[model samples]
Target: MSLDKGGKNMGRMKISVAAVFMCTFIISAVPASAGTSGRSVETTLQSDLAGSLNPEGLLLTVGGYRRWISGMNEEYGIPSSYVQSGAMLGVSPAYSHVSAHVEWKPVILAQVRLQYTLFRYFGDFGALLSFPSKDSPFGKDEVDAREGQEEKDWGQRYLLQPTLTAKAGPIIIRNQSDAAYFTYNGAGPYFLEWEYDTLVKDGGWVVSNRTFLLWEAWKGPGKAALLAGTVYEITRSFSADLTRRRIGAVAVWTPAEGDGLFQKPRIYSQVGVNLEDRNRDGEVYFIIGAGFDHDL
Candidate 1:
């Protein structure tokens, strides 16, 4: 029935984009006035982790991310499935992580970005580590980072993101984490240019479930994008009402899967790499991905 009416309109567009991102994060978690946050519209607040994605400041990219959501059904903690959704949202797979900042857009729809996020669950990345700039970049360093102590076994929470993206038609949505629910939400890393991963434990090895949907477009014969989604396994995180479903159908043509590749059949290319995995029992789960966008 037209592919089950497009998975019931992608689960009502993931519950209306999670109810408009939880009603604009509960009205910016309330508390404004510094002249209404120095004239609101400051990318919706929270950014400046030593901002710099390179506009000839050098250091093209310095990104970090660790996404692990579990719940193949937690025995009785709550979340029915997917390693009990990260141990029933205690979330702390290496402190469930994300860190990135990028720069370089002197031209072409112009680019400039500042970012902040510490994942709201327990809260504290110091709002992307506030920086009013002395041309900051964690400069004037003392270097002291002692988070909630997590190497990984369990415990995690965070989804603050920032985003900015430009490229009309073909569609693109950038939100870039103001703690927006995991996995590098939106274009915080300047619509990013590199992402990688690999994980294969051994609960026997691979059961399975997954989902992802993406639509990104960048100009020129040099840039390309598209990742029509599916595969649903984003366990849980401080839920009152959050639901996602797909568990399959992550299509990628990558502009020609080979034999003299490209002339057509792309879904974002630069030697593509997109592999998503999910498991949560016996000890075998996954999220191995890869990305590298280019424009010289």
Candidate 2:
């Protein structure tokens, strides 16, 4: 296969089983406590959506994440949610410092995302067109915004993530970091990820640019669920041209009703680590984050 063609399908197949795994998380939030009932209608919408089918509403991932941006510039945020390890080498582990809660209404899915990478704040608001499981592009030819070159590295990252979902699985296409260099210049690096899953619990496999096989336990009760993944991570220092390698793991915790998007009191938190990569080198990371899910 050609280099360009090969890079598109690098890992995570067409729909990155991992992405599909997180995409379907359903949150069953507890009913709002006494008081705070007569607030605004907007508040009510946020609240109803909170305990709805996607606990991802108002996601705050905190722990730690590191990225070698350019040759000499490196960013490591210990308590931020939107951690950007800068697509290190091949695989870069990230702790969600800031995440958005996804709300799906029959046909359209809306999202509100917030992220803090180090000191930089990134927020997102958008919508996605949903598809049936029989038409998704699980493994196809597309560039990886993170692993490959065309991906927008730095600066504003805004785009609609058009996904294909089918009985075979799903595929996602988008940019990498919100870097202006690639985004403004139209360098692209648009990547594709794919995965195949089933209604059966723990019956799916995920593929992405940096990681190999990943699986999930589909059945759950709490808004909080456990997701695990294995990866070969790559770290590149933009200024130094220094490179680092490590074996990594990804854990995502999504809860709801804390910040109460509907104006109810709801809190959110997330923590994760790439254990082996840092090893005893102290290159490890920890991300701690929290936030509110609001709507108008």
Candidate 1: where is the Cα deviation over 4 Å? 1-230, 235-241, 256-265, 268-292
Model 2, TM vs. native = 0.27
Please provide, for model 2 over 170-227, each residue's C-alpha lDDT reduced to its tens digit, 9 standing for 90 to 100. Answer: 1112111111010111221221110111110111111112322233323233233333
Error of 2 at 253 (Å): 1.8
Per-prediction TM-score to the true structure, in the order listed: 0.19, 0.27
Question: Worst 10-residue stretch by lDDT in candidate 1?
Answer: 50-59
Error of 1 at 147 (Å): 42
Write model 1 residue lDDT over 72-167, tens digit each, in one string: 112211111111011111112112223343322332222233332233222221112222222222211111132222112211223223323332
